[model samples]
Target: MSNSALIERIAARGDGVTGDGRHVAGAVPGDRVRDDGIIIPGPNRAEPPCRHFGKCGGCELQHVAESALADFVHDRVVGALAGQDVPVGEVLPAQLSAPQSRRRAALTALRTGKQVAIGFNAAQSNQIVDMRECPLLLPELFALIAPLRDLLADIAPPRRPVKVKLQMLDQGVELVLEGVKAEGLDAAMALQDFAGAHALARLAVDQGYGLETLWQPEPPTVVFGDVTVEVPPFAFLQATTAGQAALVDAVTRAIGDAGAVADLFAGVGTFALSIQQGRKVYAAEGARDAIAALMGAANRARALVATEHRDLFRRPLIPAELNRFGAVILDPPRAGAEEQVVQLAAADTPVIAYVSCNPASFARDAKLLVADGYTLDWVQPVGQFRWSTHVELAARFSK
Candidate 1:
């Protein structure tokens, strides 16, 4: 009746099926269950070594078998789209890289009077767990967590558990550390010491109110498909390397050999630059900061990318504007592109590649697109956020 034994027993009892016939394999119950009692493949059927699996919010499927998890998610998307007569395409295999891939940026909370700890928001709470290691981070980043704790000790509290966000870019890792009441040389020296010890490429310390400076003791570089992207601190970027590669490939294939393409809600030009092959790409975003990053990325790739800072929802599509492109590539937020769907339904654009993170919204939009004379050509599911109920999807719509 020790805690370990108690947890194990609970995991065992909670691991399969409940009285109501729900699958208890994953930490979150009610995930997969069929009339014949077939549990969908996911973290439900397996056990993970991390003691924090269920407590920590990072891995939703930690208790389920990793091998079967991806397909389980794929099935969910297919089911959603089936109602629209939209056939779901192949489910891209899950890219599960350990330690380094778990996050591009994380919002860590302060633990009172102890070492600095980083992991994720607690189960349904804003609090972060003081974690030793995560299976999702890169090995190098995984190695830095303990040392990062030591570095945080130098800074005074009331201002503890600073929000830290890190991203892997073309050149190197970008670090953004936020302190509520930090300032002056004390903050700079503290960050400097930590960066030197960790051999970080650049350090960005948030000075209570805003960004202080990008400490460039030395530059760090990350490689992606023979190209290098410079990562600025606090800039939005993908967390996992393998996941990004799959998404880029999906967008490229969806675009085919289009001469003119429009990338909607393009962030850092991940798809815009990737799809440009001596073609014109108009990248648009609502945020000026994101648009700047998109422009920078396009410049780095030497691709012909024209950027516009406009709210796609408010403006939707003006037929005069929509007719300029043969194809459109959209990567919208979780809400998905509702207004764009309405506009596209009325437009003459022949092709559309819609990338979404929410299946419900994608399905809702698919119904509208089908009603507008567009057919779901294909859908490729990408497990960008693994170990969670959430899944990323890319689909092509053609006339």
Candidate 2:
């Protein structure tokens, strides 16, 4: 057997691959992997910043240096395009968010005896890692972990697991605890006291019926380009502020000076509100609460936005309706917008900005649009989730 081999690149699952197709975990590009499974650190390899890097499951590529981390993010997007046989004119450099910038995250809190553990689950397992130091979460979110453990120990049932979601709003942190039942006045008082002490923007609990607001002195909101949209409990938000700006910039550049734009799957007008200057926007979303937030914000701001609460998967805007707009922007979930892409293929919209979390799905939809008439102009890869394998991108398609 060969004594050693240099890693060529990082594969999709965060493992380093050699030119000869050998996969070595924790070996970054230029690192040498020996037959005995020891990785000799190379130029692109950097010491992981977190003590819990390998075990926490919050980060998979922490072993990779910053330069290599960007490469991995860029390659993942380009590789997905290759898989779909889609050609593009330009693939811009990848943008990776800095460590400890994640604004929103879902963590698990488990109570064992008198102690409670609160953190992300380990990779491929239900066991919680009990996050002590996370480099990916915002300081505001991580600050709650210790306090949460103490609070949960008092209220949570021993050995029972509950999900704790945290989001950074403009005012303060918005906390949501699911699968928790707080009975009697003491438990309720504890929740109120926790919220007041933490200065939480809002605190909601879900005992199974649905999310019930426990404490919200004022309506929680998130600002997107001057407009403040009321945030629903545990609403979908861009993982980082920098990532949202990158995507919004890509979308604005894609639809430059367009008289009208259509934002499909517009969650709380993330793009529509940001890019709707001097133009009319038609925003559609399936989620009722999300659409309400968008509508309320747009209306309160007196912006030129038309919102419709409709599921694009079942009733996508037809080509005839889409033709009314000069440009279309679609930010679909991981499943991608197959039905919308089919309609987009036939629409007369001059430009399209697609923001996607799943590259494979985006590539699939890109294929359909390219075959119809649109030219693949450029793509902007975003590493919002940082060291995780999750890939996201913003691209432009024009006819």
Candidate 3:
């Protein structure tokens, strides 16, 4: 008899798991692993598009078929809820971002002699992969990699790694380089020419002290609904436009007809501004710069979005304050809003749209809400970081 085990599903870390509790790397659902440690390609295995698929840490599930990828995303959410014994009324279909849809990325660059290597770090290592082509980044963003290598070779310190951040703004791509020094007139001119030649919205560098803008012809802005926020350099943004749309749509649906909403942990008014048309939104964030940008945008747009710079972890909304809102939107960091959720569960809030990047933390908070009589109405999984183990989700809870 053949000694082989079938991969049943993908685990949280992107490893294909067998029924008997064995984990296989680079295996997808339906794949068979022979006793001699050879993988037999299964129906759900896909041909990875990028040459750096296995080496680059940017993506993990590129070898998974579309259907299996979606399943992995959905199962991640469902399994998380199950672990917490939280019952969900429905598990909606997973929304996966298309190839080349990533709008923001943080890459690493290192210069050795005359050559420069720029790309994501290798899997489980600090070494750069030297990206030549990527299917995860937008075409416009990917096009800059080659030129960036050339640019970094001149400015990047010898054999020292530099952090490169690329984000697409309303004007154009914003580039920020850390651990790079450009001294004297000629180097400064090169930096200016590079930004202008690439039509970059903003280019900032950090040598040691702090980030200093080298070239910024115009403010780097991002639009959240009708409001235009002149975002700070390398501010947080949804990974992809499609993913943002899916989350926004789900949030809008989750808080149907609610006239008053409290957006906790609101970053740059991504959800508050998007849903502030007829509704009165109260946006609270811990980051000063993000809240300031949101406040400025709301003030200029004259939108019914009030901004507050309050750290919810230290001082979450009390029951009295929480009860005021007809609905609530919670988009906390990876460590979910446990402190805030406790207050929300004690309050008489009617509806909630909890958006989370980490399913484990989300489920833990969901248990608290459910225990307080809130129903887990539905969950919508979003594969924003495509071909990766990272998962995002939006869920509705109602009393």
TM-scores of the models, in the order given: 0.83, 0.98, 0.98
Candidate 2 yields a Cα-based lDDT of 0.93
lDDT of 3 by residue, 1-399 (tens): 569999999999999899998999988989999988799889998889999999999999999999999999999999999999999999999999999999999999999998999999999999899999999999999999999988887889999999999999988999999999899887898899999999999999999989999888988898988889989889999999999999999999999999899999999989999999988999999999999999999999999999999999999999999999999999999999999999999999999999999999999999999999999999999999999999999999999
Query: Per-residue lDDT tens digits of candidate 2, residues 287-312?
Result: 99999999999999999999999999
The true-versus-predicted C-alpha distance at residue 173 of model 2, in Å, is 0.2
Model 3 scores a TM of 0.98
lDDT of 1: 0.68
**What C-alpha lDDT do the candidate models reach, one value each?**
0.68, 0.93, 0.95
Off by over 4 Å in 3: none
**TM-score for model 2?**
0.98
